[model samples]
Target: MPFVYMLQCADGSYYTGSTIDLERRLSEHQFGQGAVYTRDRRPVALVWHAEFDRIDEAFGWEKRIQGWSRAKKRLLIEGRYAELAGWSARQRACRERDG
Candidate 1:
């Protein structure tokens, strides 16, 4: 199975990725061999993960989550699906206003 996963880094930032083997990928991240973003952060913890039947599905999900705001990602990690729409709308509104 393929999986989309999120790691909470030591600096309170998040990293999102997809992998066929979650454990091995996570181990690599821990050892500073995973991602450049995560390598500097160090000491990351698996905060969220979802399994998919296909690697492409997992990769797609990873891309989507990578674009989310920290608050939105937190809501996802906490399983607060109800608030996601509101947060997403707020984010969009902010982006539109800023631009």
Candidate 2:
């Protein structure tokens, strides 16, 4: 199985990734051997993860989640799916108002 995982870095930033071996990847991140973005933001903790039957699905989800705002991501981390639908409207309105 493959997994899409979200890690909360020590700096309070999030790192999203897909991997076949979640344990090894997480260990690497904690030991400063992961992505450059994560290497500097060491001591990361896995805050969320979803298992998928296909690696492609996991990778695709990882890519999709990486583009989300911190607030949206936090909703996922907190398992607040009910807010996600309304959040899209709010996010779009905010973008339109300020962008």
Candidate 3:
């Protein structure tokens, strides 16, 4: 199965990616052998993950999650889909206020 995963970096930031082997990829990140983004922020924790039958689907989801705002991503990691709409509303308000 293909996997979409999120890691909490050592610096309290988040990273999202996908892989066919979650365990191996995670190991790589922890050991500073993975993506450069995660390499500098080693000792990451696997905060979220989802499995899919197709690699393409997993990759698509990875891209989607990577594009999310931090609040939206946190809602997803916490399994709080219902709260996302409220968060999105707040984001829109903030953006409107800023500009």
Off by over 4 Å in 3: 86-91, 94-99
Window of ten residues with lowest summed lDDT in model 2: 83-92
Q: Rank the candidates by lDDT, best first.
A: 1, 2, 3
Tens-digit lDDT track for model 2 on 1-99? 899999999999999999999999999999999999999998899999999999999999999899888999999999998887646656689879997
**Across residues 1-99, which tens digit of lDDT does each residue of candidate 3 receive?**
999999999999999999999999999998899999999998899999999999999999999888888989999999997877746656789978999
Q: What overall lDDT, based on C-alpha atoms, would model 2 receive against the true structure?
A: 0.93
Q: TM-score for every candidate vs. truth?
A: 0.88, 0.88, 0.87
For candidate 3, the 10 contiguous residues with the lowest summed lDDT are 81-90
Please list all clashing residue pairs in model 3, or write none if there are none: none
The positional error of residue 4 in candidate 1, measured at the CA in angstroms, is 0.3
RMSD of each predicted structure = 3.3, 3.0, 3.0
| Residue 7 lDDT, candidate 1, scale 0-100 | 97
Q: Could you tell me the TM-score of candidate 2? A: 0.88
- Per-residue lDDT of candidate 1, residues 1-99 (tens digit): 999999999999999999999999999999999999999999999999999999999999999998888989999999998878857767789978999
